[model samples]
Target: MTPSLTEDGTLPAPAGNVIVVEESDMVDLFGVWDLVMVVSGVAWHLFTVVIFGWIVLRRHHFPPFRTRNLRLLGFMLACGILFWVCQVLTSLTTGRPNLPRAVCVLISPWLAYGLGLDLYMTILAYRLYLLYWLLVLRYPLRQSRRFYLFPILLGVPTALVLVSATASPRLVSTTHYPNPGNCVYSLMYSALCVVDVMIHIIVLLCLNYLCRHIEATYNDYRETTFGSIAFILLTIVAVNVFIWIGIGPPLYGYLFDREEYLAQFCVKLAADGLSCQGCHRRVDGSSSARLSYPPANPLHQHQYQRPTLPPGTGSYGETRPNDDNNSGQEDGRGTPGCSDSRTNGCRGGDDSLVEMAPTSRGITQQPADKNGHIEEWSLAHVAYHDDESNQLADKDYTGTSSAPHPPQHDRVIIE
Candidate 1:
């Protein structure tokens, strides 16, 4: 009769497929598939560890890695590296294909709770933060107080998932003692898996919203350096999902298959690199964009207008003059109660006139007012000097006002 295949290759009845075997028999039964599985799993774990280490070291060297989002990124990467290492090592020693079950049993409840689901949730949460900043806040992203929230949100859910996962026995081990550890397939573990899928979907949606927001805010405008980097990041996220969905399930059923696992590992590493690139791209791009424009100079752009009042203070001085009044009141000087003697010199329609004396022996005229002094280099002053010279020449021809008494007055040459 055909024998039942027990967890450790044991049989209930003596049959054609069954053979009396010890631990050595078990090792032989493991075969090529087992060796391949073990090697590939170990390699993948190692690769992840190396990648995570590199990320941490690089972040420390530079400051962008120090951001809250990036910090959470490090945590997630570290968790993934640790998770895979534990799962792969346990499977290799025991010669089993069901690693998730082994992980639930052997690994610390705290790590199992936080490391896996928490990290996965973070990817989505980070995306959501980006979305909220762009859409709701409508504020340009700079280093601000918003980054601190990441660790708290990430930690809470991870702790809960771990607690729930460990609370159920079926999620960790399927069979009782005397049987080789049975790789469990249970509801709690399945829930964790579902969470993974849902979080990914949320991340994708957030990315979509981000793209749309960018389009709306910067429509027809030239794309910034940050824009390009953000696009690359989005591309990487997309690629990550594609690869995980394509390769993840195949490896689950056939963990003993070495070639397939290695392929998955390679894909995962590439995806992680993409994620790092995305983050740095955004950070560097933002910095570059920030430093791109020089501070605006009002002097260079236009003639400097003296600050008369606070910003947005209405132009209170621009109203047209009322002609009915004898005294020019509302020309930013004399009004109802206030008196201004300067208006006497500014007679007739000419607002530019300033009476000055020819300071000489016989010619006795009042000195020019220091308060109404115009700059010698000014265009108005230069024009007035020329016009005054012409007027003096005309007066001489008409025999009206006599020329200055040069003998009596030592003329101070106006240089």
Candidate 2:
């Protein structure tokens, strides 16, 4: 039997309020669906923490912490931890009625607001980083971490929590279960969600503009393997759009249906997953390093042309003998003082000069000059031989000799 209103017109306190409900009643009110969603949200947050923890452990010794991507990742990881803590507290305080009203009222709003701010800052930071990279072609390294971190991490969230705590009727009430309905805090939460959606829309538009600019400036921009910043932004926008439409006003749904809050958690997980993957890909140099382009210098464009030989000539520009007509041509074993077209010098059968071919191995044998002097070859063209081998003995042919000397020794000639 509930108490009736007094003659003074004061009504009886509501039984459904969190402050009056017993632990047993609270447990029963939490249906199976609620428990499932809560558990899943908690598990997802734990998974996020583990993933980022592993990343930190692996990269702790490296200089990656200074990079924009890692800084963003660090912020996400911190936010995930805070969010996980909040979820765990919600599960405990909402389920166990033994918690003091003062403690719940004090901590709950701070945890919730801090979580929201963390997510907001992560998206904001990543968007700004992308803009800097695209427009300036450099990182925002000069900006101190405190420049962004303090405002997002501590200052804004603290102020919001304080404002909500002071102005919200439910949050300041002494009830065991203060309902977060029709309060300043709820309005603030709704405004935050709206702001999130708006920011995402702005980011999407900016990304489109940047993509168009890249295409207009670089003829082969599409062929480049730039990391998927546009794709990541699109994904984030889609997630926010789905939340805005499907969930229908986040704060209202979150206050009435706890499942909507779970959906928010899921959205956070999705955004973090996309960001981590995109940032990791960019940092690893896998995506950005694959852009191919033509050489800058024209000389380098023809660095590897095929070796062209003179007409009616064999390898090394040596004249090929006509088989049918042996006019004044010596036998295969030409004697000393014989003019052999193949040798381009006087030759004898012993240690005969053999014309060498230019191999595909970048080895070339220059033709003798009109003064009957052998042209110099680079060391790359010279082949080496062992001293023990007597196949072709070394002979100094500096001056004219009637007897054809063997091809210059295998000793490498620099020029």
Clashes of each: 1, 4
What local lDDT does model 2 show for residue 108? 50
| Predicted candidate 1 versus true structure: per-residue lDDT over 1-415, tens digit per residue | 6766888887556546433334453332455866787789678767877876787776565654443355655666666666665554445546443234445454634453355544645654565566566556686677766665654654554556566656666555633322344355477676775675465545545544554544434321133235547968999998798898887876673466543333333323322332112211122243110111011332222121222333322122221122233322333321211123533422212222112122111111211235532111100111111122232211100001111210111111111
Backbone clashes in model 2, listed as residue pairs: 18-176, 18-177, 19-176, 19-177
Query: Which residue segments of model 1 deviate by more than 4 Å?
Result: 1-70, 90-103, 106-113, 127-131, 134-159, 177-180, 211-415
TM-scores of the candidates are: 0.34, 0.34
Candidate 2 structure lDDT: 0.42
Range of the 10 consecutive residues with the lowest summed lDDT in candidate 1 = 393-402
Task: Give the per-residue Cα lDDT of candidate 1 at 178.
Answer: 21
Error of 2 at 412 (Å): 99
Each model's lDDT: 0.40, 0.42
